[model samples]
Target: MRLSLLDRSRTRAGRPDAAALEATVARAEHAERVGYDRFWVAEHHAVPGIASGTPAVLLAAIGARTSRIRIGSGGVMLPLHQPLVVAEQFLVLDALHPGRVDLGLGRSVGFTPPVRRALRRDVEAAESFEDDLDELRGYLDGTGPVTARPATGRVVPTHLLATGRGIEVAARHGLPVVVGGPVLDSDELPDLLRRYRRDFRPHRDSTPWVTISLDVTVADDDATARDLALPEAWALAVSRQTGEFPPLEPKEAIRGAERPAQVRRRVDASLDRAVAGGPATVRRRLDALADRTGADELMASTSTYDREALLASDRSLRDLVA
Candidate 1:
């Protein structure tokens, strides 16, 4: 049960400003020292709450500050960018960091229709994701005719971040694949893993790797842990329902506010899926999830408000899992 960090640098107080950038960078540096296996950031365009909308650029900065540990996107939304550009950008990252880069690709749009259109994505673009993925692979492998100079002949391990049918494509290509959020049944995961492992045709390696990301937050006491984690859980639920990034409010504050019963129900539902408690409780839950999923790696994204609480959760996780 290797642990990694998934950062969104979500704005908690109100507006996302320069303070968030400094805090995120500091947190990344702290994560490196605290023995996190990897620090992966996400990309979300035009989202007011998420500061890491340009993960490649943030990753470059992170790579510069940290001496070791992997730095990469949890995924770059491939449908929104040109594959060649992605290849070139990541080629530079690999050149700078060498054996410390992981390229994760996701097929979905990270933004809504208006923002997607602003980024030049259309309905037809979604269908072209597989083509773009193949082209990116070819470009990186040096087999494509339009040779990406720095990337040519350079093979960086690529992972496909998938939600549904894209998992099969990832397995067929023999790339590592990541499954994220609200996994309904444990049985379905092993079946997906079996399909990936069975059908995988490795291009660079003989075996395929599978990683899963989940929401996790730990504290010394169970009540305190839940208290710290509730805000982001509520925010995620609201975002899913509304497709808009709302201002962050403390859990108690939100609960006190006048809101619909259905909205409260959604927030409670989000908390059910998230792992939050004392270290012992969290460890037991994680071990069970790993046992059920058979995931090679488990990455945790904490939605705690206090930075110290977040760091404590990371340390507690490493110690418990170790």
Candidate 2:
């Protein structure tokens, strides 16, 4: 199976935010060295834990640093930007990087109510995502009402970051679907994907594709790998209670802090959902996931406070799946 990465440019508790972007670029370089197929970044506006709010801007930097591996968003939220503008940004990326660019679009709005208001988007704005995706595809394919600039007649591959409803949109548009979160655990997942493949309409030779994304961390042992995953899991747990996702704290710091029972339970649940262990353990779980979903690719969205450890996990994951 194809192995890819989704780096969110996660910030650390004590480091400057700029460091996270630099770290993301450094991680992309490492991903190429480790034989990863694609090194994708994410967009998370006004979130304290995530330094990258703009995928295109960060992708340009990543492209300049690496030549072989594909670099793209994992993804850019369509509800917050004009379809034409989004097309232009990615068209420019394709202009510079050529065949190495992929456009992964998601329908997520801003992180919080304040962030949504800041972006001038309400919950209802997401209702336009399907239309926006259709319009965006038109611009990308040079069939829109007006041509998007730098339209070099190159088609940048678009993948939809999807759940059930989003998967239906992808099928209707004949685009690949990237699935994660609750849908992956649902008992109805097989039926959902079967329907997606069955209903997919062909657009410009497009075919049904599925990519499964989730957090994956590897280390010398199961305990160590789970420790590396703790920071991200804790950040997620805290976000639920406080509604603000903070920077990744050291695992030591997380363990040292006092927490309420609710926070502890949330943290345990988050960890349980993540795939983190020794090589054998991770491979077993991943193989089971692949058999269950028939996924075409595995996109690991793993992060840790220790940069070296994160890089090691990336290399180990590549070795396991390559």
Candidate 3:
């Protein structure tokens, strides 16, 4: 399986959010130097913890800084914007960088009701995702009713950042699917993926491909690796309790802080799901995951407050997979 990185440009406590964007570009440069196959960013609107909201703009910045690494949106939420505009934005990115762009789409409307209103989207907006995806593809392939400009004849590969139903959508469209989170632990996952491959209908030579994404952190020892995973897990736990995701705090700070029993349990559960350990430990877990899911690629969507440790983790994960 190939290796890739997905950076959400997570904000850190006590720092300007804009700094996270710069850090994302630097990390992409490092990912390229270390031979990562692809570098993807995410779209998260009006989220305090995440700095990136517009993936295409951030991807443009990343593409200008790195030469060879494949730069893409780990996804742009299809329900939040017009399909033609999304197509044109990525088309422009492809024109500047040429073959290195990818467009990963998702159906998430927003993080909260207010966010949804701000984007002029409601829960119902997601219902049109399939139709929008078809329309967007038409523009990318030069088959839409109105052609999207900066039309470079090149097709920017589209991937679905999918869940259960989204996987079926991808299968119907013959596109690659990226799955993670609770779905990875589901008993029905293997069957779902098998069905996806079996049911896939080819679209212009497209084939069914699956990329498993998760938080994979590596350090010199098991304890140290888990420590690196703590910030992200804590942030997740807090979000579940408080309904707001905050900037990542230092691991030591997270460890020393007080927490309610429920939050503690959630944190422990999140840690249990993450693949974090020394080289041999992570390798064994990844092998099991690959065997279970028949994953074609591993997109390590890891994050932490300490930038240097995160970089070391990225390099270590690349070596583990390569």
Which ranges of candidate 1 are over 4 A from the true structure? 151-153, 184-187
Residue runs of model 3 more than 4 Å from their true location after superposition: none
lDDT (10s digit) by residue, model 1, range 1-322: 5678888777767645565666677778888998888888888777877777777888888999998888888888888888888988888888888888888888876456788778877766878888888999887778776988585345877888877677799888888888886542445777877788889888766477778887788888887888878888777767877878765677678767776777778777777777888988897888787777778888887756677777788888778777
Ranking, TM-score, top scorer first: 3, 2, 1
Per-residue lDDT, model 3, residue 113, is: 95
Clash pairs (backbone) in predicted model 2: none
* TM-score winner: 3
Tell me, by lDDT, which candidate is best.
3
Candidate 1, residue 230: Cα displacement in angstroms equals: 0.5
- Cα lDDT, model 2, residue 313: 97
All candidates: CA RMSD (Å) = 1.8, 0.9, 0.6
Residue 103, candidate 2: how far off, in angstroms?
0.6
CA lDDT of 260 in candidate 3?
A: 90
lDDT of 2 by residue, 103-167 (tens): 99999987679999999999888999889988999999999999998987789999999877888
Q: Give lDDT for model 1.
A: 0.78
Q: Kindly list the per-residue Cα lDDT of model 3 for residues 1-322, writing each as its tens digit.
A: 9999999999999999999999999999999999999999999999999999999999999999999999999899999999999999999999999999999999998989999989888999999899999999999999999999888989999999987888999999999999987899999999999999999998999988999999999999999999999999999999998899999999889878999999999999999999999999999999999999999999999999999999999999988888
* Model 1 worst lDDT run, 10 consecutive residues: 181-190
Model 3, CA-based lDDT: 0.95
lDDT of each: 0.78, 0.93, 0.95
